[model samples]
Target: MTPKRLHLILLAFATTSWVRADLATNLVAYWDFEGTADNHSSASGGAAYHGTLVGNAAVTGGTALAGTGSLVLDGDGDYLDVATIVDVNQAWTASAWYRPDLAPAGTARMMVFETSGNNSFAISFGLRESGNPASTNHQTVVDTTPTNDLFGNRDIADTLTAETWNHVALAFTPATATVAGSVVTYINGLVSQTLVIPAGSTLIIPDSGFHVGTYRNADGRWFDGSIDEVAIWNRTLSRNDVTELYERGAASLGLTADLAAAGKAFVSVESSDPALGETFGTGLYDLNESVLIEAVPKDGSLFTGWSAPFGAEPDFFNLTVTASVTLTAGFAQDTADPDADGLTNYQEIVLYFTDPDLADTDSDQISDGDEVLESLTNPLVSQLNAVNWIAANLGGGTEPGDIVLTRDSGTNTLSFKLKIDSSETLQSWGPLLPAATSSSGVAAGLIAVSFPPPWVDKGFFRVVGEAP
Candidate 1:
């Protein structure tokens, strides 16, 4: 009997038509915060722009929208002081994934820029919960001089979901003494508001201190939440660029900008027991996305393991889609006898070529386990001659019961018959007849052979094979 096999093959596919030029063209600084509070930027001749974590700020795992960790902050005094990375009075773009745990009482600053004096102006990007000086929830304040400042439009509340990650971006262009500039705000990669910079305003450089998660002076405006994938660009980003960042996430910026930017990776999932349940995370994904793969077994099936490619770590679920790969999850039925036969389902399918779902696979009255274990006969073929003999002769039959062969009826030229072997005390055995002489009357169906009473009483007989 050969073992029953089940194989499932699923193909994964994906396509995108959005064209992109350069996503990392002007990236000045970046912080993924994947277990560290360091900048991952290559700006200023590959210089490092690191920060020191202030009070109650920590990097925690499994909270990032794209990576393994995110920077968690408390509303008391948590902030990151990353000196100066961007020059003031120049075009710039800033973006991050933000999720606030609590609504701000007054203002919750996400990032702040300031000069090196006590009475100086500061540029701030934050959220305002209450309409203190303005009703708008999202704000980007640009301070031009010691006396004049530009505030965002006092519009409706931005309707942010609490504790849910959202992509936010701000692009600004400074105004010259004779020319007007503009500041734009984006929520989830879409432009939400735009404010025009009035002419005759002086451009002040905030090149002294830059901080994340607090106001410039740290006057109790600390951001109380998580921030991940913080990045800045030296130039204003187009609408398409922000949309791409929101769709593909921050980790894909450099990967998608490479010359050999592999477009998409697909994950093909399969299961050994498809009748139990379907699998997840089986589709085309961005080349830099992390996907979770899993399968849900039904009530009686047990998840055994995964097949090749992931066989080394069968229980590992998360996979980064760096390339196309196929995965197969294995499952086993827990029951021993699903059809209620005496034989275990494993023996019925693996040891004997019989259906586990059917106790009598050959449609004979005898069960499959009884045919193999007790009668010593093929469970896949009905024991027709033995069944007929038992029906007619009752208890007086002496017919050798287990031999079965299939051929055209009454075909005398088949050249095959049951070769019987005898063993005394169940040990040494030998063929009852010489090798040259087979059992007589080797025709097609319903043929019964019987030995003499003395021979039967002397030893046990077994059908070995069909020999000519």
Candidate 2:
């Protein structure tokens, strides 16, 4: 083959693979009750291909069975059989929408039994054995829980609602051993509680036909209501998927043709096509939406009404600016300086921890007045720049004998005086004092030393003069 043709074929395959990655499998089973109308035999109703519902059981809602059905299993011989096509030993979820009638005496049970022994796993809802006739006891149990009294031994009670179509889901996981482990029940898309199953036990009864509506051997406790949209999955569904089912199911019942557009599949014992009655397949399950970023504040403050982004697609929402706005370089005093020079009280407190009231905050050994005069460092505890002052004044070309510093111990003051010899050039003087020394001194009798500022403490003067 030509190189051009081979490259084109490879590109086409790559494109197809990318498209297939976005698609997910759809699993749906539809059971429409419109075939050979049989009364008791499996042949009477549409090919007992899936199972059977006995005793005054017939599909209702529409003529062709495209709508709803009432599977009334109340009397001694009323039940529905769900034929086992696949082994459900792994994680699975079963859900249904049911509406029951208020019975007079006995409680109701929803059983899933095996074809052989009556000891198959089951869950029931109704009044407790000790419950008064007036109140109800909504109990849920597994096969491990004793079924001797049928109504007394249950893992959970007071969870079922009656006389209305309620969405019920049971999720099973094999790994968990706690009561909340193996099983979880959901009512109306919300998780109700975790169910406890027997250790080393599987909920799916092996080699047994899955039965619904009535207990295995017990009588008088039958589901006398309409069961629609019964679905079973090989895996537990996420919370989002459950919510989608509730919304789509409600929309479908409301006679919306675009109901599947809500991104969920509908499963039921009644099929839309007679040929597909026993078969389950995938349906509408794709809802692709884009996610956008949301902006938020960053002002280092607490936000009260903060909410995350939400929609059909992923969304990014902006958070209120909670970042701290640091006042960097705005203060008058330098943070690197231990003492603040000519700064206000607020600046001293914010920048350097110097006593804004006194010029020499730290009573080191030099006054603030002499520190400025001899080009010495400030003696404030925070602003004492002794190391930088010594490096600048003493380490340079300035002779050590030219600078002088005097401290009066009694008056607690310091005076810094610097005098230059007549022979010294003015250009050489510039290197000795980088700038003019603010002190009362005579520099070659030309530049007079004016006292810049006097401080109270003598020890606060950080400058000492070297004798000439």
Candidate 3:
């Protein structure tokens, strides 16, 4: 039979939580040194803590580490009296990006916080030169109490590169009754050193003004360099947080451009959830954070793979974002038969109008492909639904016609023989002859028989016998 024979005239039709984390969680004050250089702490609801430039301490353009400008200190007397006062008795963190023009000097102060009268310094952190520009050490002096204080230094000479931008951060955790207070320093996103406070000491820095580019009280210990993106937090920063901060700042300066030039680009796979036809691994991610991305295909689609720059990466993969790059998840449209049924996705969706994702559209123990291609049954209507066998003549009188026979409920286990007799008059019928055609399944609970051609003046048809 031609494919059209199977297409018999008998027709029937029917119709992250992913979330990105905020990096500015407890930020108290931030000075990006762009424009007029007001406090950029709005993200954390901190005080304005505006900086008043002194001497030649001006926001210099085109010499920034991350943004458009940086605060330049002329080493002589230039400084910034940042009206910042915070409770340093608890946990805190301070970070900054600096590009020094000369090697570290013994008395060169980058940041200092002191009492209003400046009787003594509460905290002072800066660089100490060791006669060698390449062997600089970072120092911090903390006044834990009126009668207690501590001063120490950590050798960051290995990471010190004069005239180049570098990141420095110090985080503190207050001491408990049984534990000593500790200070952790990070250089370029790595742990440089940790200093433990005396067990009985507690940070006693009061609400005093903070200074940048010079020691408190406008002392001659002025910083000679460009400083950008200086920030302070009332809460301690974790290792990941510090790393993210450093990487984000470095990326903004395009430090990863060399890596990208070496044929490596940050890769991030994007897709929708299977239900929404999207991918997984949704949330805000740090530039240095490695993430696991997965491709999930929505209904009527398939995940082919990832796009270029990610050759041969599987549907689920891990990636570290060191630079700014966008990745695309590849997907094949709903034209494939993933279920491996006899029908293509297009045939199931467009022609047969069945679900392509399911091998069986109806829970009747028969797959959609078999129901349509084999039994010529409707895949959507379950065979369990009761349906009485019925017959109907589509046309009459010398016209091409169809005899439709419907199947009974439950199963197609019965067979029948049809016969016909023709006569000039209704009183006497001619010898019985087999019907023009035998019964064939048309759809679920339905079948049809087509008359070949030529017709007499009258005719009669009947089911002669049945086989169970």
TM-score computed on alpha carbons, candidate 1:
0.47
**Pairwise TM-score winner, candidates 2 and 3:** 3
lDDT of 1 by residue, 1-468 (tens): 323322211111122211223567778777767645544443431446676678877777536766566777766777776767677568888787777764543353443323332434345667665223233266666666533665622442477666677777778887777888777878876788787777766545654556778766766677777877777788988665676677556343321334235476546666676775456666547777899988767545567777654666544478887765656778776557877667776566556758888877886556777777776667888776665454343323246653233233232111124445666666676765555534565443334576766663332244433333
Q: List the global CA lDDT of all models.
A: 0.62, 0.43, 0.62
Root-mean-square deviation per candidate: 24.6, 20.0, 22.8
What C-alpha lDDT, on a 0 to 100 scale, does residue 312 get in candidate 1?
60
Model 2, position 434: C-alpha lDDT score: 33
- Model 3 earns a TM-score of 0.49
Q: Cα lDDT of model 2 overall?
A: 0.43
Record all residue pairs in model 3 with backbone atoms less than 3 Å apart, i.e. clashing: 20-284, 271-278, 271-279, 272-278, 272-279, 273-278, 405-447
Q: Which digits, one per residue and each the tens of the lDDT, describe model 2 over residues 328-411?
A: 011121223233345444444543445655656566444454454553454454333553454345433445554455445444
Write down the worst ten-residue block by lDDT for model 3.
11-20
With candidate 3 superimposed using the best TM-score fit, by how many Å does residue 195's alpha carbon deviate from the native? 1.3
Candidates 1 and 2 compared: the better one by TM-score is 1
The parts of candidate 1 lying over 4 Å away from their true place are 1-19, 35-47, 102-122, 130-136, 152-156, 250-468
True lDDT of residue 365, candidate 3: 47
Q: Show model 3 residue runs off by greater than 4 Å.
A: 1-18, 37-47, 103-119, 130-132, 153-159, 253-468
